[model samples]
Target: MSHGPTPSDVAAVYLQQGPYAQGHDPHGHGHAEARGHGAGGPAPKRVIVGYGFWIFLLSDIVMFSGFFAAYAVLAHATAGGPTGRELFDLKRVGIETACLLASSFTCGLGYVAALQRKQLQTQFWMFVTGLLGLVFVILEVLEFYEMIVKGAGPGRSAFLSAFFALVGCHGLHVTIGGLWLATMMAQIWVKGFKPQIMRRLLCFNLFWHALDIIWVALFTIVYLLGAGA
Candidate 1:
């Protein structure tokens, strides 16, 4: 005969875990020890989402770290071609860096506004952040345009290739970040701080700040040191 749970057993399961629809735990883990129902899962949806997204961002950071390392090794080894010292413009880089850093700060304010449930403030600050990010990408593209026009394209030298790759990666990140910010603006209008919406917004915040940190490293290595070399 096949063994199966009886109606009384089902009742016992429900009694133990309450009516949260968290489903039956055959192991009888109980409500106090569940994974996401205010137990080991930790602070509800917001915290759990933040934790998961942070993990994703950390993995992305690792990928960027590899890119940075590769760039570092080849940034100055230009194979008898023009080196970073001959190509970089520190003033332009400084302007790009300032735009990016300011965007990050505005993003921070948007996160705070989101947490406070200030819809107007959140939307305004997010728009500001996106605008600043767009500006940064434009400046970076212009810089690249100048380099390419001056015969410093990635095909010209290993250093130039690494330089373009590292900075271009950052430029791509800002472009995507701008899209995400615009999506969030639409989301707040439609979803209005729902747990899932907030989850995504906070996740994007983590990602945006992580990009900023990578930019700092790039600025120091590619712009500051590269220019000096």
Candidate 2:
């Protein structure tokens, strides 16, 4: 005699008729949802923001890489002008490095305070980060000024040209970062840890920390190595 529909048959019918059917693939073995398609909602704001910012950062790194390669190729083409050993001041560079590194720490603290919903602490830490970043930019400007006064400007030689291009690009980024830091602090003071502000703060933190990392490389390769050369 014919048997009634079994549990497996019932389950198969439900799969086809239920909500799962919305995302089900007719030809594929597994559901479309399993492949992160069909009816799945958009990713969280944090993930989407973070992923997009990372893509931007990677593109920025590629640009920096081009500057670095140019500097490496032209480091020795001084054309009788001052070399990095002659122009670079280790003590000043060391101080700039210290300021940037310290700013990175404060940026981290600010992010943590934001996460904890401590508005005052977040503002305070971000203020400190901005101050440190401003100091870095000032020191960089002074260094550039001194070099130009000594007739070692970018126009003097290929070596100086590359030097100014690479280091100046980094300094410009730091300056922009300082402005960003100030804007973030103002937003935190006014908005008080809103989700969108927090996402912007997170992006700022990533940006500030990335600058510190790039500065470390700049300090080591451009300053340290160049000073020794």
Off by over 4 Å in 2: 1-42
Error of 1 at 2 (Å): 38
Task: Give the alpha carbon lDDT tens digit for every residue of 1-229 in model 2.
Answer: 9576676765776676754455554444455563333256557789799889988998998999999999999989999989989988999999999999999999999899999999889888988988998999999999999999999999999999998999999999999888888888888888888999999988988888888888898899899999999
Task: Output the lDDT of residue 198, model 2.
Answer: 90
Show where candidate 1 strays beyond 4 Å: 1-43
Clashes of 1: 0
For residues 1-229, could you state the per-residue lDDT of candidate 1 as single tens digits? 9467676887887677664544446544543344445555446777778888888888888888888988988876788887778878888888888888898899999989999999999999999999888888888889889889988899998778877877888789879988988999998988899888888988898888898899999999887888787
